[model samples]
Target: MELNNEVIINNLVKRFDEIVAVNEVSLEVPAGSIFGLLGPNGAGKSTTLRLLCTLLRPDSGTASVAGHDILEEPVNVRECTGVLPEEGSHTLYPSLTSYENLEYFAKLYDVPEEEAKKRIEDLLKFMDLWERRNDPAGELSTGNRQRLALCRALLHNPSVLLLDEPTSSLDPIAAKRVRELILKLAKQYGQTFFINSHNLAEVQRLCDYIAIIDEGKILLSGRTDELRRRLQSKQVFKLRVADNIETAKSIAEGLDFIFDVSIESDSLMLTILDPVSNNSVLIRKLLNANIAIIELAEEEMTLEDLYLQVIKEEEQ
Candidate 1:
């Protein structure tokens, strides 16, 4: 499949005092795709978004948003992108009603009055905040404020949306609704979403591409599924025998490439290195001892596992 590029970062760098907040980071976000940046706190995920949004001037290198250069054409870049910064809800004018808040941003973005009215009403109704549109932003609940901020972000209908923890502080239902909105907007309008989030499940569900960042460096980046498969350096598997489970376990434990072998009655849960090459050897050895292998399958790795494994390997 062909992929068109939306946001391009080239050796981007950012420093704060003695610390390098973003270090020579480079990644391409495909146009009209939901791209996620995953990392622990203080891991440069948010900083990367800030740099792309032109909120922070990079020490070196540059990025382009919707084809506008971050350094040379920041205004153009911002014009083509909408940003829901961290603490996004708090950025709204507390005294203003939700409708007024979006209206103010619409005027700032030069959105036509008629179009902004329709956009604001559509967003508020879709987010189930239509009834609360008249309520003061500060008087609304945190979740309501979050919904309002998202509406404001979308009021201009920019091509690229940069979100920092998009669903933070939302109830479960509210979070789900927000996820639905993101998916709909990305697929329906071809809006490219660049998100920094600690929510692994949300990322797994929403993002077609994801990058793992740690301490200002990208540990991995690719199509979400492809990235996980590439990072499957080692895999955990389960082995079972129709009979002679003990003998099978004994022989399996003696193999150097196999690890974390544990026996529970008829099943053996183990970690294997290079299962493609080593599983045949394992089966051969077990069968030589007259062990009947019933089942041998690898465990599926979850996003949480992928993140923790990458972070742990980085420490090593």
Candidate 2:
């Protein structure tokens, strides 16, 4: 699908003192999709986010958010986007109730009182915070507080959402709810979401597009499905046989297409560079050897696996 490319970043760079926070990073975020900025800590994700939100200036390169240049038209870009900063604690007023917090941010954003009130209530309900609307922000659970923070972020209904670790502090159930809500909002309202997360499973399940960064540069970026396809190029498979587990594994190790072989419980795992064309021949060879075939399956690679691969490749 051809996306509108709500976010276009080209050769972006940011430096602090002698430290380069973001370096020559570039990617396009499609409109109306959940895009994940994923990496380990200190991988430049947050710094890139800061630049995009206009909280920090890039030393070089260019970025535009929602059709507005981040550097040249910061105010317009800010007006077009809502940011749920990493410091969610600082974003919420501890002494104020959830409703009051939203009211305050709404007013700050110049949302009219009548519209703000209705929207606040709608957001509270949408985030499942209605019952706790009157509760003080300081006293709400981490999850509730996070929900309140999100409500404040949406108060102005900006075209894009820049969320940094939206579910960092929530319990699994709460995190799941937040994930579901993110998907719902992205679909129902056609809003573009840029999420910075260290949660691999969350990113894998939620984001349609992803960018993996390390040090100060982008290691890889593309559609999630495409990335997975790239991983399939390094596919591996495990086969089980009743006898000669060791001998069968030796045979697999000798095959031209096989990279390595290891023994598992009642099975032999073959690490192959290509499985699509080699698997059938390997299985047939084992069957002809009178080895009782019990199980045969491809090893599925997780997002964590792919992430490790990206980081390792970048390191080398």
Superposed model 2: Cα runs more than 4 Å off: 1-3, 87-90, 236-245, 262-269, 274-304, 307-316
Per-model TM values vs. the true structure: 0.80, 0.85
Count of backbone clashes for each model? 0, 0
Overlapping backbone residue pairs in candidate 1 total: 0
Model 2 whole-model lDDT (C-alpha atoms): 0.87
Return the lDDT, model 2, position 278: 82
Query: For model 2, how does the per-residue alpha-carbon lDDT over 51-120 read when each residue is reduced to its tens digit?
Result: 9999999999999999999989999999989888896756799899998999999999999999999999
lDDT of 1: 0.87
* Regions of candidate 1 where Cα sits further than 4 Å from its true position: 231-258, 261-304, 311-316
What residue pairs are clashing in model 2? none
Q: lDDT of all predictions, in order shown?
A: 0.87, 0.87
Of candidate 2, the 10-residue stretch with the lowest lDDT total is 300-309
lDDT of 2 at 136: 91
